[model samples]
Target: MKNIILLVFFVFHISLFGRNLINPLNKSKDKNFSNIGLYIDGGTFGIGYSTFFNIEKYLSSSKSEKIHLFFRGSYGDVRFLGSGSGGGSFFKNTQTIGASITMITGRGNHHFDSSTGLFYRDESILPLLDLGYRYQKLNGGIILKGKIGILGLGFGMGFSF
Candidate 1:
């Protein structure tokens, strides 16, 4: 997983400068205009998966080239999957739903995900940070990309059109 994440992130950065990808929200602003993709985030503290559907919109006008705010949420996770009648078994599964904001640095993208919801009759809070490059295709269709952070890394091919 680590290797795959690295490879994808490398490719995204290379594509940024090489293709002059449109960042939409520059670094100066306190928010990112719009972004829609699959969120794969986790941390060393927990052994679970996070799937998110995000939508970010710009709040101000900035020319520094950065992403500030991006609306985010994690659908749920498959932590528990087992069943028995004779001798019931035990498993752990969870899900999270919350809000998040981001701030971009100089070279890479920086963002965070915080979600809290009930999963399997249990309450939980899941927070994560992601740092990587986001690429926007020139054709204005779907954007294939990846993200690497302190928690877990994600490599996904998505669309922005």
Candidate 2:
């Protein structure tokens, strides 16, 4: 998982600079905007919302891609599967808070994002990794994300604004 995450990051980093090398004159201007999204995860059967802020411009002007810092919060009632008749079934209300750094690649309305971060759950903080793709119109768009964290492996879809 760590290797895969590193590879994804490497690929996006290369893509970000590769575009600049290809055609410097054709490079687009920086887009700095905040996005808010709601998502549901299969790992914990949780629903969450997140806010992303594009902070690359403030940090540097040389880069052509956007880098975002995001905060997410989620809530869910997770059922313990396979408890059997003797053990019965149990459910827990779970909550999580996370922060991540995301790099955005591609152009126009369609973009790909690679993110890595950390989340707090069940009294412990754990690393979180995700690879996501989004399609945005003027203000908002749809987002699809696959992630691995303390909650395990999960996929989610939501609207981003």
Candidate 3:
């Protein structure tokens, strides 16, 4: 099930953002960026990574606020170390999958961001929300965001491609 979901996610990303597919809107500098970042907590409650794209910009509308739709997932290893009968350490892994929609408003490299989403993690469903700040370039470059909210405090670093 995990593999299948991951596969579907990758396929979805390719179909939507592949450079080979010619879209007239992609020519515009502001609309051409996609982001992938390593996140810690960030309302996810677990350490993982996320990828997102500018949906509104991709659709060719230059709205007051740009909306980004993020697809996030992770297979994380939780290790228990002890000095008991079992003697050493054991590894328990967990799977997480979620999607979020973020609204961002700003002119260029600085922006105010807010996000809300839901996730299935460790056999439980969780709600995520956050308000934050983002630093990223218009064409494509690095991405940095810090947020806090219902899920907790979180930070991310990645490149906008």
Write candidate 1's Cα lDDT for 1-161 as tens digits. 43335435533553444322344444433433333334333333245334544333222223644323333433434342342122444443333333455443332332232222222212444445565555543223453345665335664444532
* TM-score of each model, in listed order: 0.45, 0.47, 0.58
Candidates ranked, most accurate by TM-score first: 3, 2, 1
Off by over 4 Å in 2: 1-34, 44-63, 66-69, 73-93, 146-153
- Using lDDT as the yardstick, the better of models 1 and 3 is 3
- lDDT (0 to 1) per candidate: 0.39, 0.44, 0.50
The number of the candidate with the highest lDDT is 3
RMSD to the true structure for each prediction, in A, is 11.8, 11.6, 6.9
Best-fitting candidate, measured by TM-score?
3
Q: After superposition, how far is residue 144 of candidate 1 from its true place, in Å?
A: 3.0
State candidate 3's TM-score: 0.58
Native-to-model Cα distance after best TM-score fit, residue 45 in candidate 1, in Å: 11
How well is each residue in 3-86 modelled by candidate 3, as lDDT tens digits? 347646655664566543333323345555544343333334444333222221222214433543344443332222321124
Residue runs of model 3 more than 4 Å from their true location after superposition: 1-4, 7-61, 65-93
Candidate 2 versus the native: TM-score? 0.47
The C-alpha stretches of model 1 lying farther than 4 A from their native spots are 1-48, 65-68, 78-93, 104-122, 137-140
